[model samples]
Target chain A: MSPPLADLSAPPAIRPSLAARLAARSGALTGSTAGLALGHAQANLAVLPAVYAADFLRFCQANPKPCPLLGVSEVGAWTIPSLGDDLDLRSDIPGYRIWRDGELVAEVDDASAFWRDDLVAFAIGCSYSFEEGLIAEDIPIRHIEEDVRVPMYRTSIDCTPAGVFSGRMVVSMRPLRPPHAIRAVQISSRYPAVHGAPVHLGLPHLIGIADLARPDYGDPVTVKDDEIPVFWACGVTPQSVIASARPSFAITHKPGTMLVTDRRNSDYAVI
Target chain B: MSPPLADLSAPPAIRPSLAARLAARSGALTGSTAGLALGHAQANLAVLPAVYAADFLRFCQANPKPCPLLGVSEVGAWTIPSLGDDLDLRSDIPGYRIWRDGELVAEVDDASAFWRDDLVAFAIGCSYSFEEGLIAEDIPIRHIEEDVRVPMYRTSIDCTPAGVFSGRMVVSMRPLRPPHAIRAVQISSRYPAVHGAPVHLGLPHLIGIADLARPDYGDPVTVKDDEIPVFWACGVTPQSVIASARPSFAITHKPGTMLVTDRRNSDYAVI
Candidate 1:
């Protein structure tokens, strides 16, 4: 027998992200990129001077869970062709946070004017890929359902030190019932590049997070009494580490906003 | 260059369970078999009349997490050749519990006297296999450390019913810090024939477990303040099911005691 009509009528499973990338470059999509490019992988951006680039690379290597490096551009390059053929690091992301001496100086739609010959862009994997996996498994995501940014906190767990890039790890939280929490662990482990499995779950205080309601970054979603607060190593770790390291100059994507990439999310599923 | 002398001096990593199985068969090891066979796989036994064997097999198929059938013997047969070359179902286990009309009537070192010509024996995977995997990965098991039986409880989660076989799932609990809990999930997932990953974690009451201090089957293990109570589907589910179903006659391994098999735990590691 032939396949069903719906299967024949359906488009390819993975959608391309070139249009979204172009929209960001044109300053027409200057907001949170969450759910913007379905089936495409999103990335956390980090641009630093060549002097600190090698140290940051070591940092990511030593602490892969929180800083999973996807692609890195050569010194002074504005594009990482491996991530996307038309990917322009300076303006392909809808939002950018320019840092001076580890302090956020400005948030802008374009970083082209601030781009310099010494800048090196590092693309780190984001949790959106695994979140998509969880959603596909019918696991409900609290932040997505509530229409709010995921709750993130500063954890007491220290990252393995590498040069000046050292700080406590930051984690994003999701509240799920026990069964779904177990399912999340299995599903997320398949995508090792995207923070992998949770770093902590159940007891928050053990990880040094005092209050689930008062997050260090992003907005808090309701955590039901019966639910477990599962925490994953957040991509925001690099930003926090940069803030602590006090680099003379650095650039990162604003929280909740990410660089949309041309790669399919399925490519990141290791298993 | 030749390998180190120590490598040549060391014996094979996986030790055979033949001696341990022989001891049980001879009635020399008439007690708990928790650590009797170090590198071998142990199984929970369930013997039923041939009339109920088909329904029991369907029940196991419908609820694999709780009743992972490792092997089954022919009606009136006493050996499962696949599990062991000379495995005698009637006397290979360290201890046996005989049930009559859903009530335990006797606990004996060997079931040879009670063995019937119309019975079938089932070998269900036990957690001891994955516990070895967890220990190999340096994940501490609380029950082993405390020298107590791993706690088993009756949960609100119901198993898929088949004919006269039906009951709520029974789970084994282990207290672990959040990080270790996550690691245990990943490690156990590789051995799906042995209960696979956890069914629930953290909140006990959510699974109808009101208190951690009291368990329905095995002795309770200490749960640290910083640790999360992780629960996995226990092989004891079949025992509970047989009891609730009020079968005319049934046989099972006593709590904390099991049937020593020739199969290495590594043989069950699917990944």
Candidate 2:
């Protein structure tokens, strides 16, 4: 049987800058940014009122693998000039999930209407950057190969708590043969800002995942008989923590939709 | 109780250069170079007849975690200038263990007496470099604190085979609390030329180590109630493989007594 189509379309002639992309989004560009902006960094977004920002920053620092901080906007400011020339936190991301008292109130294209002067925006390093590295190395990503979302699970491993933010680590899984898995470890080790290497491999149940077919988050992909499941700490972790913490107000990028930044993925590579 | 004395001592005024140190050996150094040449790299030595050198090189390449190659000498050549000026493989190391058909035949200060025109020397990176890094980070090493050798064990994990060299990996263990273990992973990861990050952690039995108190090599240090055993692939693995390969002739540095080179440990740090 033919393999499923990957979102691997050729780059458009007018490669947009971070500002151009954000400007183009009349509302928010609510589509998956998987293969867009090939060489640039994409970020997971989290906006919280200034009151919870300090605790959230501490949370990211303590749980780096899951919530590697890329950039942080000042309270009452939507611009992170270091991340982009004129990035606007309210409308740059393709979509935003607005939460009130830990309950999802709405999924909106633009968060400008809901933005408060006391809000602080956190831009986090995303796994999509490392996936590019993996593809460049010719290691097959099962989900991309099958055209499905990478499988994610809520693991028994608990994140180090910081103030009111604490929850089980949510991990994304990919199945690969042992050799590829080893190579993946070496490649991923170069990008610590993007989750680094696998937290666990080979056994899923050991991390409390009962079934490979039933992931707690994204859709499951095929796991061949000869392959082992490799799990990486996912950026979804902060969202999970925010949910549990039941913050009075919180804003996050919708699943799979991220903020494209001017910074290149290579900027995050350590070696 | 006062902490046990570290091997730290003032460097002798002579402050011998790599060449001077080798010249002064008279025979081989025959003593642990642990606290000497504070910043220089120390290497584990392995010399084999030219007939088996190619296969051994391949083996090191395939299983880098256990045998990270720092330098390899040309057949019959005594020097690896990249590692140190005028390095004489046969006499630069403090001591050598001569093996004939897999059995250790003798321990000599120098292997110059057994040096053949067909012999090739390999210098493998040692853990001592990363130990310097760990110490610099203020991470307490239990064995170092207790003035005992680090414990080591043979694990069930097999090394990737190349030619006739194949065996279970030998690992050195350090017991540390969870927080320190996490920090160690981040620190050691910067020095891939050494063993790099740990191969296994937490549960010892999971890696086939039946008893933490009974080490296969080196003296077992205390494992505290809150600590977990962290294991790194050891340079001893190649020596173990040499024993099993039963090469017609082999020469290796005596355990703990390595060849000091001009390269600094910091030179191997990736970031």
lDDT of each: 0.92, 0.85
Candidate 2 residue lDDT tens string, B70-106: 9999999987889977667778888889999999999
After superposition, which runs of candidate 2 have C-alpha atoms over 4 Å from their true positions? A1-40, A48-95, A101-104, A108-122, A134-250, A261-263, B1-12, B16-31, B49-65, B69-94, B109-120, B140-171, B174-186, B195-216, B219-231
Per residue, candidate 1 scores C-alpha lDDT tens digits across A1-271 of 9765666676765335877778889989988888877889999999999999989999999999999999999899998988997788898888999999999999999999999999999999999999999999899999999999999999999999999999999999999999899999999999999899999999899889999999999999999888999999999999999999999999999888898998888999987
| Model 1 regions lying over 4 Å from their true place | A1-15, B1-15
Q: What is the lDDT of residue A146 in candidate 1?
A: 97
iRMSD values, candidates in order = 0.6, 6.5
What is the C-alpha lDDT profile of model 2 across A165-229, one tens digit per residue? 99999999988765466567777878899898778776577678999999988898999865767
Task: Tell me candidate 2's interface RMSD.
Answer: 6.5
Best by TM-score: 1
What is chain B's TM-score across the candidates, in the order shown? 0.94, 0.92
Write down the TM-score of model 2's second chain.
0.92
